[model samples]
Target: MHENIDPAICPVCGGDNGCALLAGQPIEQCWCMRTRIPKEVLSAIPAERRGKACVCQACAAGSAPARPD
Candidate 1:
């Protein structure tokens, strides 16, 4: 499997943003995290686990693991 890592800077606030969202929350609860995932990798995630796995904007922009779509 792949190991996910968060970004050093927050894509939104441009600050030291760390991993805050969990692996199973509503998309609306963390829109920034979901938007960070790449289309290709997002597709790779299982449909059933999409909502369970999500990454913050910092991680997404950094090309980290994204929530499944």
Candidate 2:
């Protein structure tokens, strides 16, 4: 596993993943539980980060990469 992996962050874009489960909410309450994260989008995340953190909605929806900030 990658060091310092934060489940609250997006593994792909390094942004806030907004995972309800990470926020102490039920797993069923997480948006990811209801949404279908595309295979291509999931493939974008680095191997070290995959499954370590949640991908953000934008990344999961294939609408974002690294955001300008």
The most accurate candidate by TM-score is 2
Which residues of candidate 1, in runs, are more than 4 Å off? 1-18, 23-35, 55-69
Model 2 bad stretches (over 4 Å)? 67-69
Pairs that collide, model 2: none
Candidate with top lDDT is: 2
Candidate 2 global lDDT: 0.83
Q: Write the per-residue lDDT of candidate 2 for residues 1-69, one digit (tens) a residue.
A: 338878888888888999898789999999989999888888888888777888999998888766343
> For residues 1-69, could you state the per-residue lDDT of candidate 1 as single tens digits?
763433433333334434444435564665564564677544554544354444345455654543332
Alpha carbon lDDT at 38, candidate 2:
86
